[model samples]
Target chain A: MRIIDVHTHPVFMRRGLQRTEIDWLVAHGRALGIERMVTLGDVLLHGRFPTGEQISAINDVTAQVQSWYPDYFVSFCFLNPTLGERHVMSEVERCVTKYGFKGLKLEICNNASDACMKPVMEAARRWNLVVLQHSWSMTNIKQRSFHTDPADTALLARRHPDVKIIMAHLTGCGVRGVLEAKGLPNLYIDTSGGLPDEGLIEYAVEHLGVDHVLYGSDLPGRAATVAIQRVVGARLTPAERKKILYDNSARLLQLN
Target chain B: MLCDVNAFLGSWPFSIVPEYSAPQLADYLAQSGIRRAVVSHLGAVFQPDPMLANRKLLAAVRRTPALAPLPIVNPLLANWREQLTELGANAAVRAVRILPNYHNYALKSRRLDPFMDALAEAKLKLVLTARLEDERHRYFALRVKGVPCKAIAAFLARFPDHHILCTGVPLFDIQNLAEKHANFSSDLSYAENITMMEMLRDKIAPSRLMFGTFAPLVSARAQAAKLTQSPLTAQERKLIYAENARRFFSL
Candidate 1:
């Protein structure tokens, strides 16, 4: 079956930059039935809070990866929402206008429910772009001040209601994350990050509906084949598998 | 044959993972091309005395020859030597796993010296479980953490004669241990990355890294794909998938 990974960081920490590295990655992905991948940009390249220039540089790496194989890669503009409206709007405008990025990627910049996210959501609304928020169960991470927890992402979706929001890391978010995403049509969760814990994919599908689930491998930290197989190995029907691995992402990103 | 060094037969209470019976587990592993697995019981991890769960595990997997039972041994327990004696009765159990954090003991505990010596006497292998669930994703009420690398490193230094198969450890931990200790081999359940095999080749040898799937809790198919779908050569794949496990467990 065809697959589209909605979350990935193709060039992480200066790796996957060489021609050989990119070729091998694309080949590995293709062999595992990944026809397209959405690059989230190396958002943490500049650490939790990067300067405006550093954020731009990170997105540039994504743009370069997309250019290498435009047909296979979809770019997302990585943003530091804590940078306030002007900086947030400026970066989103530059990345979207210049690179035709299809989405906005939010890492541990600020909690998704924070006031500064106003500009980030506004930019998404303006560009008609998807917002993929990095979310985990901050019950232990204890960095909710800058980190986006599932509850915070749910609040962001409820707050916006108009913009599409994808909560990242189903494993990190766990059962509570799935429940947090339930009943919110605007909010979705991607299977990415950490170990491929069983029953999470099925739980997300049951609670959030199949359409709201997307396949993602926080690449370089996670593996695509492993991520894909997690969905495949789940107790879902074949149609549910296809929806997660391909249809949902394709529809979300308008990939025909 | 793929020998999964980290397969479980009982349920993890925190999640919805199926509690597999021996035959059901055998079928589950077979679906992922695993013909053999070193199995354990989750009851042992949480119970007051692991021997009850261990004996149950031995009986549970009796009909299913594909799964070899690896009983959990709590070294801190008063009857650890007796536990070994009872497990040694079967003579099929090649290894016994220890969950230090779950059992509320330190990997650096001096109790392990006598315990390791006892294991050596029985000719049973040791499987040190660094973790079961990822700490970041564990149940909010569960505060148990992964066994620390420093403790493991010190344990390895103290028990150089015993070749321990460390399961559920991350790839970097395996690399760190490989640099200083030659006696420990790790299962590739928690170590994940893009181009995983290629990344591992730089740090550890093919013989030192074995295949494992924290199945029932983790997807066995996905964990198997970590090796089968990688850049590993057939020889490297063979070693990791089953050869290393066979030699380590004497299967």
Candidate 2:
């Protein structure tokens, strides 16, 4: 089965940044049938609120990985919207024009519902790039001020219907997250983070449909084989499994 | 033939996972290549009297040969000896499980010393559950945390003669506990990383690691694949998948 992981941080905590490490990761992923991976950059290396230069350094690492294995990786430009519109727009433009980043990666710099997201979403709309937001339930974690809850991501999608959005971490989002993403056609949930809780993939598919559920592994922190198996191991038809593992991501990112 | 050491029967109120009958659970596990499982009742985790849940669990799996019943014993209960006696009387029962966090007792509590002695005298194995669900995703009202690693390490030291099997232990904790203590074995229900089994094999012997799915709360197939798709030697795979569990439980 051909698989495309929609979320991964190949260069985590300064690891996997070298050519040798990248080669090992690419080979490891391919061995488990991953045809391609979306490199979300070291989004947290500089902490939650990184300066503009720090953000560029992180994106540069992602660009370097894409440079080595252009065929194997799809780069996403990591952004901290709290850096404001001028910083956000310029970084998006730089990543897209120079590095050919395919999407925008948002971590816990600010809530998805904040007013600062306006320019960030505008850059995505202007560039026709997908936006992947880091999200969790926030019911217990209680860092909703900066952490993007599933409800907050859902609201982001609701506000900007034209911009494509991917809510990362299906297990972290749980049942409430699925319902928050129920009606919004623009929002997608990545099956990444937390334990591969039983019946969650099935539950997501049941509520949001297979098209809205994409395969992801939050890799380096998670196993690509385990993440792929979470979808394959589900009690879904082979066709549904194929969509999540391959086709849905292909369609979302316009990958051939 | 994978023998899951961490499988559960009944519903978890926080999850939407379907409640399975013993036959149904057996069939579900069989579909994912789990030949046999050591299962405990989920009802016991929340109930005031675990014996009521234990009786229901015994009755549930009595007819299913594929599942070996592991009854949950609340050691803090005044009638824990009675619980152990009744569970020991059953020829099919191999081990008794304890949920220290949910049962509102610390692993270091003196209550467990006598309880461990009873298990030792009864010739029954002890299955200590570190956690059943991820605390980050649990219900807001359920504030219970996983059994602490220090408490677990202390417990291992306290019971030097007994070999304890711990379920739902994280990967890092497994490494820490394995380095300091040799008296404990763990199931890979909650242990995960890019090369999870390979990493664990480097830290702990393959013989000390057993396969567990934490099913009905976590996916059986996904948890099994944590080993099945891992870069493990055929010997390592054999030990973790069945041999270790068989020897641990004497199944």
Candidate 3:
């Protein structure tokens, strides 16, 4: 099966950044039938709220990974929207122009519903870039102050209907998250993060349609084999599996 | 062939996880390359007495050969001996599973001492389920946490002779137990990491690890893919896939 991982960090917390390590990841991913990987920078290296320079350094490492294996990896610009609109706009423009970043990655810098996200959404609109937001169910984590729950992400999509958004982590978001992203045509979900719980992939496809779901591995933190297998093993039809595994991500990112 | 150490037969009260009958579950496992499984009834999870549900599981899987009935036994109940007696007599039960968090008993409780003795005497294995469902996304009203690590350590220290099989233990918790105790083996039902088999091999031996998909609740293909496509050797793969379970459960 051809695969495209929509979420990943080739350089994770000072690990997997070396040339040999990067090559190992590329070769390993290629062997697992992964055609391409979207490299989201190590967003947690400096903890939740990173400085502008730190965010740039994170994106630089992501760019480096892409440069090393241009055919295998796609870079995404990591931004902390809490750093105001100027920082968000400048970084998005720099990464897109300098590194050819295809998407904007949002970590837990601030909740997706906060006013700070306005600048982030504006950058996405101006650049015509898909926004990949890190989200999870907030019932247990209790970090809603900075964390973006699935509902918060849905609200962001509802507010900005023009910009395409890919909500990361289907397992973490659970069944309710799929339903929340149901009606929004501009919103999509990636099947990454947490344990590959049964029935969740099929549940998402049933509620949100096959085209709205994308494949992701959250690599370095998660295994490519397990993440891809989750989609492969879902109770989905052949066409649905094909969309989640390859076509949907290819079409979403406009990957050649 | 994969032997699913963790699977259920009835509907979970709070989950959208599909409930399957014995034959249906067998077919599901077959699609995931699982030839056999040890299954319990979800009805036993919430019912005041697990005996009714246990009997139901026994009757349901009677003709289904692929699914071996592993009934949940609540030692905290007053009629513990009768429950054990009934399970031992009718079903070809090799092991009895216990959910401490669901049954409202700590692993360190005094009652488990006799319960352990009874299992040893009965020649039935014990499967300690640390957690059935992830605590975070569960129903808000179901306020139960996993059995504590220290309690599991104490339980292992308490019963050195019984080689317990622990299901749903996290990867970190498995490492913690391996650091202190050597009397138990664990299933990789809830354990996950980037290079899981590589990391586990560095910390613990292959003999102590077994394949578990937590079927119907966890994706069997995802869990199996972890082993099927792992970087581990053929020998290590055999251990995780079936040989270890065969030796551990004497299947």
Prediction RMSDs, each to the true structure: 1.2, 1.4, 1.6
CAPRI classification of candidate 2: medium
**RMSD of model 1 against the true structure:** 1.2
Which residue pairs of candidate 1 clash? Answer: none
The sequence of per-residue lDDT tens digits that candidate 2 reaches over residues A1-256 is 9999999999962244688888889998899899999999998888989999999999999999999999999999999999999999999999999989999999999999999999999999999999999999888898999998999999999999999999999999999999999989999999999888878899999999999999999988788877887888898999999999999999999989
Interface RMSD of each: 1.2, 1.5, 1.7
Question: Highest lDDT among the candidates is held by which one?
Answer: 2
On residues A204-237, what C-alpha lDDT tens digit does candidate 3 reach at each position?
A: 9989989999999887767888898888888789
lDDT of 1 at B75: 91
The DockQ of predicted model 3 stands at 0.65
Every candidate's DockQ is 0.81, 0.70, 0.65
True contacts reproduced, candidate 2: 0.77
Candidate 1 lDDT (Cα, 0 to 1): 0.89
**TM-score (C-alpha) between model 1 and the true structure:** 0.98
What is the DockQ (computed on Cα atoms) for candidate 2? 0.70
Deviating ranges (above 4 Å) for candidate 3:
A13-15
The alpha-carbon lDDT assigned to residue A167 of candidate 1 equals 97
Candidate number with the higher lDDT (2 or 3): 2
Model 2: per-residue Cα lDDT over B54-77, one tens digit each: 899999999999999999999999
